[model samples]
Target: MPSFDIVSEITMHEVRNAVENANRVLSTRYDFRGWKPL
Candidate 1:
């Protein structure tokens, strides 16, 4: 038998920051116009 602890975490602030940056880039870039991340 084996037992272990699994833990996971997400930093929402960083995630939001990244998404905002990406969105800004996508919006400004001509090639990425109308593209959105799922």
Candidate 2:
């Protein structure tokens, strides 16, 4: 039998940072100037 711990291998901090960065960029971009995602 084999087992794996996939959840332990993922970095949530990095994922959150990337998402925040993307949101910042999108918010400042001309096309999405006033767009906000909630």
Candidate 3:
């Protein structure tokens, strides 16, 4: 038997930052951005 408590919080600032980074990467990659999904 194991008892444990895990508490965590992620700020909106961090989430927004990660999203922005991903968008930037996507925008800059011409192949991925221009390619059509099949």
Candidate 4:
């Protein structure tokens, strides 16, 4: 067995921006406009 740690060094602002961008794309993309997130 082994143990490990992962770090991205991503800031809160970066995370928020990424999420917002993804949501914006998902909501506006015609193919995904009617799709519902699970």
For model 4, residues 1-38, the per-residue Cα lDDT tens digits are 99999976979999999999999989999888788888
Off by over 4 Å in 3: 1-5, 35-38
Give a tens-digit lDDT track for model 2, residues 1-38.
99987655658999999999998889789998877678
Q: Ten residues in a row with the worst lDDT in model 4? A: 29-38
Candidates in order: C-alpha RMSD to true structure: 4.0, 3.5, 4.2, 5.2
Clashing residue pairs in candidate 3 are none
| Model 2 segments more than 4 A misplaced | 1-9
For candidate 2, the 10 contiguous residues with the lowest summed lDDT are: 4-13
**Candidate 3, backbone clash total:** 0
lDDT of 4 at 15: 92
Instruction: Give per-residue lDDT, candidate 3, residue 36.
Output: 47
* Candidate 4, residue 9: lDDT: 94
Give each model's whole-structure lDDT: 0.88, 0.85, 0.85, 0.91
lDDT of 2 at 26: 94
C-alpha-based local distance difference test score of model 3? 0.85
- TM for candidate 3 is 0.60
Give Cα distance to truth, residue 20, candidate 4, Å. 0.4
